[model samples]
Target: MIKNYDVIGDIHGHADALHRLLARLDYRERDGAHRHASRSVIFLGDFIDRGPEQVEVLRVVRAMAGAGTARAVMGNHEFNALGWATPDGAGGFLRSHSEKNEKQHAAFLAQIGEGSRGHHEALAWFASLPVWLDLGGLRIVHACWHAASQACLAATCLDSAGRFHGEGLRKAYRSGTPEHLAADVLLKGPEVRLPSGHSFRDKDGHTRHEARLRWWDREATTFRLAALGLEDRRSELLDDPVPAECRYEEAIPVMFGHYWLSGRPQLLSPTASCLDFSVAKGGVLTAYRWSGESVLSNDNLVWVAA
Candidate 1:
């Protein structure tokens, strides 16, 4: 069990917000010396893509990890980014997002130089990230634990092996390929199946095969979690306890990032929490400090204005 730690949500290349947030959290270099303390940062992943400062963010995080001030898990976006760096297919999400850092990407590629030690080192670092970290009773992952496959579980079960397996998973991040880049789809839940013989219609009365995922709004007259089935494309509201079949229950308090919670971080379930606040979109990057049984919010670490 880490004595005092802070769990941060996805930064998504938001270096400015990350810096601001870290300052608010009182994270500092130990005056040219290394020190172990009661506080450390646990990044929940998604440190790249969909934001402007991927390179800067990477450099800072790499430094922090080297200094033992912080640790990070592998987010799906990072996996996608690494996959794009490979020689195989178009790197999918990685390639598409490379536009944000075309120059840095090129420089990074050049430094690595094909078949050189730099190449191997870069890949090794990317590949060696952890998928999930168990801090005492708290668990940190990029996304929901329920969505994790047996292979993912196997890779993440032990700390040493988990880090290696996580690196391998990052290296294999490609969509619709044999390696399974769509881990989110696998973990989020099965595609909704339409009711038998029921035709699907949108609120606008248009027919569709897929239903949109639901957003939880406390102020809404009807506050509930729902899922859409493919056939009828209709949403069914769930009960308060939430069905055990929903894949929310696990062995520990799972904190993750990936899902954009509109503007606020979501305290989804007592066991599951999402911290991504879209910092790049002028939203806050949040953190929750966990003690024995209480989760404390350091709102001062919120980088963006409300």
Candidate 2:
């Protein structure tokens, strides 16, 4: 097994930033794939949508994965893309073709036309990706890393390798099912509803009544303290305890993306770090050099500006 890794965050189709970041990490292009002599990349996903160069990003990432220089987990965007394209068997898509859904997915569709060979291939590749990678010491997941959610998925939607197929894939998309809950928890992170009349506008300017919680923070007892990316409006938040199910109590070093975190890259705790730096929003493309460290450190973070 490859012990050295460069765990990368969400690309969001920013191919230039990704290339620069890979270069900064000393990866070199060879034989149609970016490779490292002694290291491999573990991408946290969100490889498409919301930025230019979606096709290029896919080409590079797919080549590296195909060349065995990189591995990846399915991000929410990738999962959504699969759902949007898959037939629901009820005369509708697994994810509806609503205006909001279509708009959110337009960038990808624009670059890789729907029903084209590229689109179909991308969907198949995404479906093949596992939701999480447990590397004994280092765990890689796209969002929240909760044991209960992982266990739930393992028993239902996920196969022995954490991938979805056939009945499992359908169950993951079915609303109100345990498989759906498991998928959401792992792919979209755990969210808790805000207090009545308390809502915050996200980075995308969308108002959200539900807030993603800081599952890695054991001391975050109140909603204000537990919420991620809502520090500016903490005063308006109610002093409510987050649900116990939302906390991550594991000691394993787990890296994730999908938080759209800004500023300098750093560990959330000794065991948790959010690699996503909002590269699609002019933020940096970030990665953490994992050299088999049992605990994460800030010094390992490497990035390139978007």
Instruction: Output the lDDT of residue 92, model 1.
Output: 47
Where model 2 places Cα greater than 4 Å from the true spot, the runs are none
Overall lDDT per candidate, in order of appearance: 0.57, 0.90
What lDDT is obtained when candidate 2 is compared to the true structure?
Answer: 0.90
How would you encode candidate 1's per-residue C-alpha lDDT over 119-195 as one tens digit per residue? 56546666667766767777777765544443544543325546535434543444565335335442232233334
Q: How far is candidate 1 from the true structure (C-alpha RMSD, Å)?
A: 7.0
Q: Give lDDT tens digits, candidate 2, residues 13-108.
A: 999998999898889999999999999999998999898999999999999999999999999999999999888999998999999899999989
| TM-score against native, each model | 0.67, 0.96
The 10-residue segment with the lowest total lDDT in model 1: 214-223
Best by TM-score: 2
Query: Which residue pairs does candidate 1 place in steric collision?
Result: 84-91, 127-167, 128-167, 147-187, 192-229, 192-230, 194-231
